[model samples]
Target: MKKILSLFLGVSLLCSSCNDVLDVEDISNYNPELVWNDANLANAYMANLYPMFGNWNTGADAFSQQLAGINFYADRITITNGEFKLWNYGRIRLINQAIVDVNKGRLPDAVKANITAQALFMRAYTYFEMVRYHGGVPYITVPQDRYEDDLAVPRNSTAECFDLIIKDVDQAIAGLPKKIATTSADFGKIDANFALAFKAKVLLWKASPQFNPSRPFNNAYWAQAYEANKKAYDDLKAQGYGLVDDYSNVALVERGKESVFTVINSYPNKVANWDNGVRPGSESRGPASAVPTWEFIKEYPMKDGKMFNDPSGKYYKSEEALLQSFWKDRDPRFAKSIVWNGKVYEVSGKAGKRQYTALGVAHELDDFGVNPKAGVNSTNLDRYTGFFILKNSLLKLAQAEVQQYDVDFVVMRFAEVMLNYAEAANETGKMAEALDILKQIRKRAGIEPGADGNYGITANTTAAMRETILAERNVELAFEGHRFWDLRRLRMLDRLDGTTKHGVEAIAVQANGQDMPIGEAREKANRYELVESDFRYSLLQVPRSGVKVNVVPGKYYFFPIQRDILDRNKNLEQNKDWGGSFDPTLP
Candidate 1:
């Protein structure tokens, strides 16, 4: 396993030829005999597939605004066909080559089955990525050994591609291990549960409104999705997989009980310095690129499980009162996931001391002398949304050692599986089962269950339960990169269009004492006055220069196929609403 770590510790360590997999040339240097005969070599080849996993920490794609809901005005959506539109056949070719060689290898049946199953999983995973992003794609299973052979390949229908994906996953499940130890030796490898979980997710997406936009929702698709999620939930629970006791630490633990699948990492080999992007300026030298939006902050329910925006609730009397009490007596997840004003945080190597994001304290003395908002500005990298992401901050690292924090990114977890099952169950009229699952998640989040043993969810009708499940998913999975996709699949992206994102404005109270304290002390001394702003809309202004942020419903749903790809492959079709001279059918 250590050797496996060495082979896949960094993206640089992967075979250089991997990027050239799509190239139509002689790659006999990477012949099956050279890799498949040796187990270590075979494992190394499989390791290259890890990079293809989705970026979970940042909802990084044209569709998503930066994590903290800051930079709402940035050109988050692609206006035209971009690089991602260009089909990169490299990974598929690599998987095809692996499958080809694994079949020809002389390894023992058990060993060969494991390796082959892994290759199959990669193949299915790759195809799923393609279909999700580009609709139907060319379903190339066999390795293209020659340039002439590669040219003959044609695109397959979306349904056909999904069918192949399912077949590959089903076969992989048949051959993969049911479970493996969380120890370093087996922590990152795919298993039967991983396949099941992924399959359930795939089915749910297939049934989503984005995929099936017909007038009457597809009940059959929803039924299939429900069954798949139920099977995954039951089997995973049987295998001792369940939610971690604390929701805050779920991402911190490596291959914990909650993680069904994760992108494995090891220090120095595959280190992940998430702090480089999300850590506050006061904590690290890295840029604070993703800041939470006021929209996101308002999503969390009150401690009593009531919606924060409920008019009848005494959540706040005024904007100023809300700003002062927002971080106090709220959901336990708030403190663990967000860095707000007046919060005391520790800085590594700064022994017996703490850092505070108090307003009026000059965190950075600009040329204009002491700036009042410097403390919050420095911590927020000047984005000034009045909040920093703490969920995946990796703040334990010192300023100088920000790059060495290595924590595996959980791709799929039991909590999500339960949510998926609950949503599917609710859609299929299994209300009791749905509520039971929600209760378990809310209970783990420190929310008190009601007399009915449910998570105080009074919504018994399907329509009401649907909204509840979506809101719960938003908070529970915040900053883990599911919001954009969830909204897209639910056909709810229109909800964000023209919406303004807001934040609090904190002004520190200046004192006239000789030994005036700073940081947490200043906060405790009531030396800061927090003001809530009325113009908290995301579309109010552009946070990033030279970019327009707008979500055009019809055209923005699917990214356009690249023009170059259309020219290269005449058979390929452009997505709907993306006007181009390209035709869907070849003459």
Candidate 2:
């Protein structure tokens, strides 16, 4: 169904999520007393405060080099870089003011409760973002007056920050409805399920090594995460959220079955630029571009759920041989999410239009035509890497229709919730449970279940399970902005040190010189391009030859508070790892 409205729409018909400031319509001109007393006006006020939640573009993925950009070639992230600093006291104060005023509003008790609950949820969300970047921000629940209130508030401890987050989430859950259907008017609005899943995610981060480096695994923190995620998983499952059978169709529908929470999107009014980022500028109407890096391509497994180079996987071959067939026989998601050379990509409302990325590999004018253009103009998209992220692209959209791309951007989905639950379960010695979730996810991705029905999952031990879960998360949640945080939470940024991620740069040749078979790429090439064979692959580093990926600073786990923010707040201490007295990690 085409969702007519999102959370902003659910709150008030006149409200638009496009505007994320409280005073969008100069609400300051209206009497605060009258606005709060009126239900519709109060709802509109809160609607403006809801931060558009989904990472609609290449955001956190850039930090992990999953999406190509300058970040992919960066040497390291320093405290001075301030790559992750979210000190939004202004928004926090707004939420606090909303919570305070909504309570005093003369609306009915239920109406007052709903608005207050939503405000609290937003507050939790804002704080979560803050803590994720700069751990232990001031945990202020009430709006502070600049002139009267103590302006020098010290940063709260990590424990206190999370305590308040969970406390607010619990209260929000109590006031919100259990489940709001994606088809309902309140489709994108925060509900009990949304809050619960968010709580689980928050707890998962809290339990991670980012906060508790002392206890690596099997700690009280993981147990807390287990309970919250299990509750979320059970509650969400009972309410009918699961993996959409076909991966290709998952993001096509607005607030589809697997989505636990998504920001409501409608073209013109509130458009997501996801299409513009995925589609190259050649076929796209917008200039934004983000393609999968070589790291992400290798991260995906073979069709039966094994790495291309895995010794026990379906395909074990040399680096050259593997990258040659990299476009073929992979996790079914590879087909759903990648657009490589000679791949048939739908655009201009037509099927069988080939995307020729390799040099000299020009596509036929149309599938029925034998003639080739003078040059490889169709391949001009020449995506940064050898491929483009086809994840959630609107396949049938004509080039002009890209501006109308309004697919609901999923924030938290059942797949991620399951991953969260599985991680917690594995850390708590529930390997079987964790493995089961992985299997289900693989099944949904169309991985073939072998005779033993293992789906090529080989991890058995807890540590191995941890590795597999994190690896699975990379592929299952690629480009959704999860990888960088996952690496940080696991305290594994060291893995990126001196790492040279690879990308394929293909060039067409007269005869196939490569040893490996091109697999299904030939079939796709035959259907969409003038040349179907004799392509040679070049293994190129994603970055320039000498650029190093050194992430040595421990302070990077919790980004430092911005220098300006520190200059403004005299009492707020910097994190200990950042050469200050306060500790961001939990006690």
**Best candidate according to lDDT:** 2
Q: TM-score for candidate 1, please give it.
A: 0.86
Q: What TM-score should be assigned to candidate 2? A: 0.89
Write the residue-wise lDDT of candidate 1 on 1-587 in tens digits: 45664654332223365434323353644656656777776777777676777444444422444243433333444535363453657777787887777878877788789888988998898788777776677888887766547464466866777778899999999999988778757667889999999999988877777777763244577898899999999999998999888776797866689988888666777676577666666566654666676556666776666666556443533444555567655667777888765465555654434333434442441111123433433333235455667786665688787777788788888999999999999888898898888888888888755456565577879889988999888888877777777877787877666654445444444344222334544454233332222011121232432333454454455567776667777776677556643222111
Candidate 1 clashes: the total is: 11
Off by over 4 Å in 1: 7-26, 54-80, 83-86, 150-152, 311-320, 349-362, 365-382, 451-453, 510-549, 580-587
Residue-by-residue lDDT tens digits, candidate 2, 1-587: 13323334433333343343354233333355756777666766776665547547745587675765445334244445555668877778778888888778789999889888988999999999999887899999997767678978899998999999999999999999989876687677889999999999999999989888898685689889999999999989988899998888777875677988877777677787777667756677653367677777778888878788888777666667766667777888888888776666776676667776553333322111111332333322223666777888886777788778888778888999999999999999999999899999999898999878989899979998999999999999888888878888899977654455555666554444533233344443556643324455666554443443544455578778876777888998988777788888888
lDDT of each: 0.66, 0.74
